[model samples]
Target chain A: MAKKEWEKRIAFLGPEGTFTELATKELFPNDWTIPFKSIPECIEAVDAGQVDLAVVPVENALEGSVPLTIDYLFHEADLFISAEVLTPIEQNLMVHKNNVEKYEEIESVYSHPHALAQCHKYLYYHFKSVPLSQSSSTAAAAQFVAENPELCVAAIANVAAAEQYDLQIVQKNIHDFHFNHTRFFVLSKRNDRIERDEDKQQIKTTLMIKLPSDRSGALHQVLSVFAWRQINLSKIESRPLKTGLGDYFFIVELLEDENAPLMRGAMEELRTLGCSVKSLGSYYTYHQK
Target chain B: MAKKEWEKRIAFLGPEGTFTELATKELFPNDWTIPFKSIPECIEAVDAGQVDLAVVPVENALEGSVPLTIDYLFHEADLFISAEVLTPIEQNLMVHKNNVEKYEEIESVYSHPHALAQCHKYLYYHFKSVPLSQSSSTAAAAQFVAENPELCVAAIANVAAAEQYDLQIVQKNIHDFHFNHTRFFVLSKRNDRIERDEDKQQIKTTLMIKLPSDRSGALHQVLSVFAWRQINLSKIESRPLKTGLGDYFFIVELLEDENAPLMRGAMEELRTLGCSVKSLGSYYTYHQK
Candidate 1:
């Protein structure tokens, strides 16, 4: 209940129509939210007390971990995840209201490269011979297509963005995978820990660590503590330590109770491994829609 | 000997005027080249025999790996890397040649989202009070800025793109990292690998694999082969196997010699791990003016 003691102003990466805005809204409905232009800024705001909490996109199913978000989380201190949100995304095929051509006559497809990528299958099947132009974002693409009547291009954007651009939807749900969800974490400056909630089935603690150099079986030795304790790992990703090419930093999510016997044993073993370790925070994912 | 072989058709990701186009010209000087809209299509062209070779972006110092390119390499068959190029990147902020003001006075700033991300520092410093917009590519962003002269907007683009759009460089070298370089790989359906010349100093091989399930020490155990062989890993990443969460498909890169004894032993031990393994190819990066 420390959350109530704090005002809990949540900060996120955004400009209102961005996906991070959507993710942040999904987590804290009533909390005051501020938008930052970059992940580092969001983290900095949390650290500097400009905001009480921060939400950052960590990974996407198709694109892997967002590297900048990973880097900031790895280096940031005095901040920990207060909660998490998994958002299932549906990107639309958006075009300007002025365009009045059938899908077959469309000459080009425009979107942010990532949006273009997410809709690769649809473009390949329908517009295999047509040109695909990259815009800065789906919203920008729509704005571009709005002005370039000569381009006859459609952009892959969100329904909200389509509405914002007054664009029509030519097609929808074009991503290759049906379950396209992004995992986001809410960060807090305060060190208040999460109380175990019985309603949630999957409990995950997200952490970052650096292992010793010139060592063999170092990571294995770290993992064994968890496996022996019967704790399951939800995810593990390694980033360059940023010190050099050969060095690395790892982010892991453990699926176990913080106070569980096996988990405590695992943490002890991890500390014994003699590496720089920091607990980002623990949160649960609720499968119920 | 392949270098002396007649001629080869190379595919690159471009419509011309892209960083990929510039890198392609460097890799294949005056060779018959076909440009594809995306990296996947370029690889598909090589796989489908439409072209003998293709070039794709591998990793960026600022953005880490291009996940689709790696995932595509993981799934590609009968292909090998012939060479690589690391191009230094310099991002520029541009606007319509007409209006000028601090970024705060502007309503929007356009660029490829990646470009936006690279110049995020500058944008945050200047445009935190304004709106930031993203287009599909830097070129598109420049073009958007060119057309929207009446709107107080700017874009993060490249010098070449600024020239193409007839926009002025509002700022240059806006990326947070000064040593930003994107590594590109030249791939071929033919097996003619590069013979190390005096210019070559180091070699890297791209590898894809699946780690055994619930095996505590599996990845560490597998890495031992490389460590024992003194092989330095260049990169390692994991994508979900897509069977479900908790399962992963991993991609790794490490140094290699065509006939090194330790390298051979490492490959053998890696095979014994009972995982899906694919080698993209081996190549070296050399300095270029």
Candidate 2:
């Protein structure tokens, strides 16, 4: 079979039916999509030129940052963020369709650790005695339950997973918090400027910063440049530099475009203070309603 | 057995033979230590006055902060950190004594997700085909391997775990990072000032700060208060406030005594700026050789 000329290839973190896949489908409806088992694999596909773009979850409202995606982007890949997608996360309790009537008899529950933790209160209240197990992902748990009919297990995943794996939803929206959402990044090898949709798109620039090791207030100095310019920062996260303990490089995301003069000035000032600054990308964000 | 007047009870995150246990033993050599299955349980036990103090790992050099410990302290428990213990981590590969000769035939490896991740390169290079499973803790994995000798499973744990479970060490120091260290906090119900050990002890004050939501450069201003006074921050980590996405509270550790005039001035300035500041504790840190 030959692919159509207009159909672009996209890769997402999945075994299928994961939130990343849902975000991919929403973003690239007509594109040919492929599923990679892990975040690194998804990013590698784009870096290897196997796919035109890759979509992976970078942060969850409740779970915080996904270290793998952040670390890979900072340390390994030369990828750029083409766009950001915000998807609402709804975790559900699902069981195999064949065992729908026996949902109460489930002896074990399975989910990705984050998903399990998000629904900790619910699980503790309802299934306190059931043995909880960790799966590589929520979709993997659903797939496992789909394949093993004799094992009375329930998986905490999204509604898509339940439908894809032929599982019945025993409970819906079981996550502890209502404000659950995950931010996914659309990664590409090229640093092409994203086309902005007026009134809907907002520009964001993410910078990886390393401060001078000996400085007493290096981080404070770095933030001052942006502070004086009134550049609003959406987030600032510190990741280990991997050299040793107490050594870190920060990831700062500013609500400004890459070409903004203020941002450029901040970068210049930071560099003057012996700080290493790398621009991850300046991309437009899309909210999935 | 009834406890003696001089002996105090302490709770740790463990089923026994964990790195936390090793840290507990070093910090309180004569205390009666109890092992709880999880971090929350250990902290809760202390909060309920079941133990004199609780020892829990707060941060690791390689893996970053232990969120459970941080979140529990910030949200649930009204406990204060009495002391900090820095322990070097050494992960090893162990198996049942009966399976020593059949090490090559091992079908699966089990360990805590962090331990398994720490030894990722080693496992990928040597036991690429072996299925890696997650256990509640590294010690729990060792105990499982010990009890199930017929199952050719290996556990990545500490040397203490191997000895406690009577397992054979197939490989030693398999962790990828040599500078691996875990910071454990000795938590107590009362905010008792720790006696300084003079030369070896360094006083650290940890503050939990929540910025007024509407302020633009609130974090920058908060840092400026410390920056101008030259208060060295050992670490600054942000955990979700859990009210919504983008809402966060910072856990800042400063290298100064709690009652320092500069510290008091900074706290007062922050409070005047409408920022809520809570002192988690001011404690002395001990390094275990």
Highest DockQ scorer: 2
TM-score for chain A of every candidate model?
Answer: 0.84, 0.94
- Model 2, stretches more than 4 Å misplaced? A95-110, A120-134, A148-154, A168-171, A196-199, B98-108, B124-131, B151-153, B196-199
Q: Best by TM-score, which number?
A: 2
What digit string (tens of lDDT, one per residue) describes model 1 on residues A113-228? Answer: 87787778888997899888886556677667666766667877776667656778878788767777777777787655544365455667876877777365566666666655
- lDDT tens readout by residue for model 2, B1-289: 6787998899998988999999998877887999998899999999999999999999888777888899889989898989988998899999999999999789999999999999999999999989999998999999999999989999999988999999999999999888889999999999875564652577899999999985899999999999999899888888888877778889998988778999999999999999999997789887776
Query: Model 1, B32: alpha-carbon shift in Å?
Result: 4.5
Off by over 4 Å in 1: A1-45, A48-52, A87-176, A193-196, A211-231, A240-247, A256-274, B1-5, B15-35, B75-78, B90-176, B213-216, B228-230, B258-272
Candidate 2: tens digits of C-alpha lDDT, residues A107-200: 9999999899889999999999999999989999999999999998999999889989999999999999888889999999998655746525
Model 2 deviation from the true structure expressed as Cα RMSD, one decimal place: 2.5
